[model samples]
Target chain A: MGKYYKTTPWVIPELPQSLKNIFKKNGKKISIRKNQVISGNDETALFSNTEKLIYIDSGLLGQAYKTYCVNKPYAMSIVLPGRMVNYLHYLEIDNSGDIILALRKSDIFTMTKSQFDGITEKDLKDEMVRYCKKAVTSDFDAMCCMFTCDTPQRLAYFLKALAESFYDDISTMPLVEIPLKLSYAEMSYIMHTTIRTIERLLPKWRSMGYISTRRNSLIIYK
Target chain B: MGKYYKTTPWVIPELPQSLKNIFKKNGKKISIRKNQVISGNDETALFSNTEKLIYIDSGLLGQAYKTYCVNKPYAMSIVLPGRMVNYLHYLEIDNSGDIILALRKSDIFTMTKSQFDGITEKDLKDEMVRYCKKAVTSDFDAMCCMFTCDTPQRLAYFLKALAESFYDDISTMPLVEIPLKLSYAEMSYIMHTTIRTIERLLPKWRSMGYISTRRNSLIIYK
Candidate 1:
């Protein structure tokens, strides 16, 4: 599974500059350290009770969805810099168990429902709809790919997507390589497999000169 | 598996009347027979080069997602009346292999991109965004449930969902029973399993006095 992320050419997108500009101009910004859990579906995720537009300034934010059969949740989405965390929550169509934690120290902005509504020009709203729906659609596609793809293909995609999430720019071309905001346990959790599976795959990939380890992140050399 | 829909309480929603009002008042309506394939990601799904908003007027619509491992596409969404199909395509974010077909003789309306933009009031756009995001989120959750739930539970959810999709109103309560838009082969396709499995489950469920056949649809008796 670890090897699959290397071979997969799938690239996750960064938030677009236009949308970023809207947030920067009107949204309140804040920062949080790594491992902090930013959640919803109980009390408000933000200090405010209104719906919000969240812009990730930096760092990795992870979300997972669980089903009845498995005790573990499958990694649903990974938010990198320049994107909002929960558009559905903001839109108020549904509220989900947020449980998205900052994998690294993260900088983010929160624009309340009023602020977002005030800035809701038709063009911007159109763009937001496009981005949010695409986020949900492709994220589901990725999950489908993850569970159904062979271990090798799954690992390749997971790594490529992980590396791609670091940049503020969204692209589709294959990346050269990057990782650190992951541990073996986290990898198993994100991949929705067992720690034993992650442990078994890491050594083989490491010996094959496919990946390396730093302080906390796994760097793909391949 | 066949009995699960009877045991578990899961209900699919029909399209809302408000949305239906918007489509009925402003969009062009057309009808297609059962099994008609309505597609995207290739030649235009609509005659116009521009994107269009689709509102199902009547009958069931089926969409499936395929991954690398499985040869079959998983039952992704079953679209009922009043709601729009492929909002991402309408919004032009990403295009998928529009494999959604009319499961029954479906009457639907097509509102062009320009038409949509023209009618895009702020409140309406917000509602649209909310609806689309919720559709994607819960639909993905449904897939997660399908793949992860035990066979009995899996079949239960599948059948209840199948029945609920026939109506235009979306609900979450458990359904009493209904069926007929499904064949065992189609059941295998939607459930992402073998026909043999469908064959194996039907009789056991029948003997248990759970389901019976009408002219076309299966009627569930809880």
Candidate 2:
């Protein structure tokens, strides 16, 4: 396995008093084990209350997917830390049946929708809107990449996106290490390709000195 | 062309006073020709002012896409009337170079972000959030369909979605007519399949009585 190392947690510079108050009043921080189902299953809806949001405080990777059969499911998108999860449920959007899965150990905070609405600061709301937009736009970009880019390019793009999510200052990072454990099948599913395709391309990428396999993680050189 | 016909527009049951005031203040309704570019490109940003939102009042079809080269572009999502467009830009989401195209003639209304914010009513903001969530979830569902479903099933799903966008009560409509002109190449691009695949499957779908071609439009039976 890749060496397990603790990285410094990302910190928000400042929060408006209104938002801080919401977090203080309604937020409940919870720790999730790797490969845990954060939300969405027969047992529980993503937001059982439908009036709350799950804020990812720290994590490397997460996934949202829909289960068709008990054994067959398709991943929709990879989730990153520092973004609100299940905001859609709070908004009362019909997801058409989807669930959130934690790809790694993660820290998340849950707060009620009423608490979120109490924050009247425009800047804070604007920032939340920006994050939502980024989440949607990133999903759109991933779809675009799947359709337009070649397999190799698509893989590279996915890696770069994952790396960017972890480190905001991507330029200074010489090597981007994805701390999550991803099997070939999982990678294939996320990239919309077959495991065979991933196996074929990884060797070529390794030969090109673009990426290296370290235990369960993939390391991309900058 | 499929018989050109007019349909009654969908009506919002009630609007909050704050929302109504926003519509009165910043809303400007404009008519666009068929195949118009509503946002993005050198001519337009998704939202020229991060402080504006586009509300699709009446339209059959619209498309949001990203252009990579002169000839290579990826269709991001299909736009439907009665939904808000460019809401993402108002939230300050970078679309990473995506543009919106009207697949058919459309009527749209534009409003300023400040005007939108003036609507302090929780219900109004909740409604907006619901729309945003639906937009993102729909895109994610499309991605899932593209990855897991077969081409014919995928095409059927797309057609059903398009039809649902037009008719709110889809079950009541015996025949769902898609007024948009989509060549096989366009369908291929949107479905992430080859033109040959679309051509091959379309005839099969026609023979199976799932859909019928009327000029360039598709008429699907319920």
| Tens digit of per-residue lDDT, candidate 1, span B1-62 | 12222111222244456666778889888897887666543352444223566778878776
Q: What's model 2's TM-score?
A: 0.72
Per-residue accuracy of model 2 over A46-76 as CA lDDT, tens digit each: 4442545777667734445552423345554
The model with the greatest TM-score is 1
Q: Which predicted model would earn the best DockQ?
A: 1
lDDT of 1 by residue, A25-92 (tens): 87887787876656553342443223556778877776655343446644445676777756655545
Query: For model 2, what is the alpha-carbon lDDT of residue A98?
Result: 53
Q: Which ten residues in a row have the lowest lDDT in candidate 2 chain B?
A: B1-10
* Candidate 2 displacement at residue B127 in angstroms: 4.6
DockQ of 1: 0.37
Fnat of the models, one by one?
0.49, 0.31
